[model samples]
Target: MTNLWSPITLGGITLPHRLAMAPMTRSRAKPDGTPGDLAPEYYAQRASLGLLISEGTQPSEDGQGYLATPGIYTDAHVAGWRKVADAVHAADGRLFIQLMHVGRRSHPDNTPHHRQPVAPSAIASGDSMFTMSGMQPVPQPRALETEEVQQTIADLAYAAKRAIDAGADGVEIHGANGYLVHQFLAPDSNHRTDEYGGTMKNRARFAIDVVRAVVDAIGPQKTAIRLSPGVATGGIAEGQDNDDLYRYLAVELGTLGLAYLHILYARNDPLLEDVRRSFGGPLVLNRPGRSRQQIGADVSAGLADIEALGVMALANPDLVQRLKTGAPLNDVRSALFYAGGGAEGYTDYPAIGIV
Candidate 1:
């Protein structure tokens, strides 16, 4: 059986291991959307992972969702990210920026422009989000005009270029997590009657266009996408037809020859196999809520080419060494996952044989 330390090639980049550090929102950026000093240190500490997918970063001003979340479109954002990319590269670790456009999942207070959130339709998420003023109901968003949708795709392409200029290994479009792309994919959020709405093909058009634009900006080998099938987290409510939508979306995206497709699987649904067949490149699977004992089994069983980890990578900087040596794993504190600051569940975790 291949162990977790086995090497895997993700597109043109060759990873030293099959373990990828999944993107987790840290909410630690500067107020201006620039990644702070702590950001580089945090990512550099966990550079042992085969690949590090940075936290969800907004691709444009209106894309900002949570307060202090990072951005990649501005010059300041690029400079901030350059430091982070250099730090990770110095450690010989590969990094990819996850481009996230929150769509209706945004708050005016969280963004600098204080602009109303926009989506495929004017409907509200019926959910609340965390802001500087604490939890509040998500306000109704304005619907994007047909022409504005094209500009949004252009914004993503520009951001991908900026990320590459900032020294990232690649860019991963955040098409999941109930963000802008997911909102279009889910029938509940997308209520438009234009070319971007209605049937599965139309609904998937916006996401495909964004992907194509990003791929065109920085070749397909440097582009990737993250998708969640049938899991309705973060106020996203897609009906049973999610399987069909993903099957068609995946096949369409596969034609572009993207670097990889990262799927956050909810269950052992038969569609998982369909997605694997639909995507014609490297596949990275994140088995949410899986225990440590089940890690190696999933890969050995041919379920995924690479395994993505979240809290484990958060708590254990040397997770690869610990797992390979059969050492005890660090216990993660859920409370401090987004509390921000240093050494309090961020870098306090000890390395293998240290404790």
Candidate 2:
């Protein structure tokens, strides 16, 4: 039976286990979009997880949604990430930098350019986000002109190439969580009549294009993407057609021979199996709030090839060994989840013994 500890090969890398560290935003990057200095140590500590997907790093300045999130398209960003990649690799961990474009889920005050956000449509998510001043309401975004949409896809490709230059094992496109790709997928968020909107196939065009571009920039083995089907985060409403949309999407993505497809889900449903069958590749499933007992359930059941952990891996740097020996986990300090005083709650969590 395939379990969490089962050896698996993904993207040409043989991992000792199936447990991977999910990308969680820590907002710890520098103001210029470079990763913080402690990023190397933070990731190196979790090297036992084998596959560490870095926190959502933006593809461009306009791609940033949260404060201090890293970017992958610049020299400073590349150098900063190189340090992180070297650290993780030295400890036998493979790194995949997640390229995320936040779309309309951003605030002007938080962006490098203090301008309105952009998306498939000019619609606003009507969500609020944290900024330097305080939490502010998300404003309406300008719709991307057809030309700009093409440019955005090109930008993603460029970022993927840059990720390789930084010595990352691969790049995972953040197509989930009501971001730019998700905005194009949802009809409500995308009102375009062009080749990128309207029908489900059309809405899927942007995502498919982005993936193809990234795959072209980097080889298919060095490229992956994360998707959330039923998630309503960032005011994304997939509506009733959600099931059909994803079936079509999975089948389409499966054709590209991607390294793996990461699915972020809240509950298990037939849709999960549908996607697994249609995707037909290594699937990494991240079920938020999954308990310790349920660690290998999906993998054992053949529903997923790998399992992703967020808070559990965050608190336990030696998560694999701790579980292997049955050790207690540290409680999460929710208040300091984001960028805060240096490494208090970020990397101060003890491995197992030393105090």
Candidate 3:
């Protein structure tokens, strides 16, 4: 049985454990999208995890979805990320920066330019987003022109390069959770008739192009992608051919020889078995409702190479120790998660023995 404590290799880098720190948005970046000084300490505190994937960071101005989310396209952003990378590396940790483009899941007030959101089509997500003025409705986004689709892919590649230049071990393209790449994947959200849409292969083209571009910019060994086939977050209702869409995507992306594929899994998701068979590289499984005792169940069952934890890692800096020792986990104060407090619930989470 592959236990959570056992070592594993991903992208040629060996991890001491199978527990990976999943990315969670803390909204701690500055108004300018540069990560704050506290960000390094926050991540370094949980460096014991096999892999630490940073919060979703915008790859371009139009990619910004929420206020205070970080960006990876500028010098300031690179400098800020370098501190985080150095800190995590000092503790012998590996880090991957998650490149996220929120697509139409944005309000004008939330962006630095106050620009309208863009997506595969001009449809609104019928959702509201948190802005400086509180929550507001997400307006219908302008559809990206055929030529602009390539530009968006270029932006993602540039951001991946910037992350690597900033000292990150690699970058994970966020294709899940109704983001830009995902918006293009789901038929309901992407109603385009161009080369980038309509057919399942066309819908998967943008994501594959973006991945190939990122792999070119930063070697395939340092590239990865996260996919959520069954998720409908941000009001995205997938079409009837959702299974076929992902099956095509998984097999296509799996052929790229990338580092690993991280999946957000749910109970009895049939696509799990398909994706497992199609994708030949390392697979990291993230079960939404998994308890500590079941951390390594997927790995023990040979279904996953690593177990990725979100809330457990957020609330417990020493999550590995707590899971191993069967110690109580600190309760997560969800309110403080995105409250912008530098040290409140961010870095103040104590390990097992603190008083």
Candidate 4:
């Protein structure tokens, strides 16, 4: 009977427990896309969680979508991340940088290029972003030429290698959320008649290519992907054949022998069972708004090998200790969750017995 307290092996590292800190954007990176000076302390403080997947890191200038979000395509970015990896390692934790390409979820003011956002199609996500100036609507993105799409995949592979050079144990591809990969997954967002659209296989092409390229750059044992089936956000609609698409992805991408497949469990659809069987490897499940009492339910039932915590871990840096001893958790300051370059809600959360 495996439980959250049980140890599990994932990728190139073995966790002391099944609890992993899910990636949450802190918006504390330098404007130049380097991890901030306080990044090391922020991550090191939460190292007791064993496995910490970093916030979304763009792989290229065009991949960025948020203000002050980190990027991994430069030597400066590598150096900044090296501090993070070294700090987390010194604190006895393994770091996995999640490579995220926001695609059309971008505002020109938020990124360096100020180039129109690029995506599988020329469509605006209809989502608002809080840029440096103020909140603004995401503009219609430029449809990537087939060559540009290929370049995005190559950029992800290069970033993965850079993350490794920065001392990260592994890298996780951000295939979930209404970001780049999800843009390609959803029918409405990916209207191109190229090899990446129309049929389910074609629509899944970008996600698979990103994963395969990452695996090639690093190793199968060091590559992981996160997916959210039936998740509609940032103006994405999965439409019909949602389950069929995911099933195809599970079976197809499974052949690469990825380190793990993290599913953001937003629905109770039975497709998860098929996904579990198809992936046939380590599965990490993240359930939004899940209570503390329900933490290990999936793992105990064998539906997931690990559980990922977002705000719960964010509000409690000593999350592991508090859970083990049944200590009261810290309340999350929702307003400051995304406050860039501040230590108030970012690193000021008190641990157990600390004033």
lDDT of 2 by residue, 1-355 (tens): 8767878998788999999999999999999999999999999999999999999999987898889899999999999999999999999999999999999999989889898899999999989999999999999999999999999999999999999999999999998989999999998899999999899899999999999999989989999999998788787878556678888989999999999999998474689999999999999999998999999998988889999999999888999988999988888888888958399888999988967
Tens-place lDDT digits, model 3, residues 1-355: 7776889889978999888999899998988899988999989989999699999999999999988899999999999999999999998899999999999998889888888899999999999888777888899999999988999999999999999999999999999988999999998899999999988899999999999999999999999999988787877867445878888888998889999999987544568888878988899888887887688889988888988999999999998888778899999899998996479989998887796
What C-alpha lDDT does candidate 1 achieve relative to the native structure? 0.89
lDDT string, candidate 4, 294-316, tens digits: 98899998889999999999999
Instruction: Kindly give the stretch of ten consecutive residues in candidate 4 with the minimal lDDT sum.
Output: 236-245
Candidate 3 residue pairs that clash: none
Error (Å) of candidate 2 at residue 70 is: 0.5
Instruction: In candidate 4, list every pair of residues with a backbone clash.
Output: none
List, residue by residue over 1-355, the lDDT tens digit for candidate 1. Answer: 7666678887789998788999999887888899977888889989989699999999998899898899999999999999999999999899999999999999999998999999999988887989878999889999999999999999999999999999999999998888899999998889999999999899999999999999999999999999997878667766566679999998999999998999998784578888888887888898878788887776787778889999999999998888888888988898988887566767677887687
- Model 3 residue 69 CA deviation (Å) reads 0.5
What candidate 4 gets wrong by more than 4 Å, as runs, is none
Model 2 bad stretches (over 4 Å): none
- Local error of candidate 2 at 37, Å? 0.6
Clashes of each: 0, 0, 0, 0
Q: Global lDDT of each model?
A: 0.89, 0.92, 0.90, 0.92
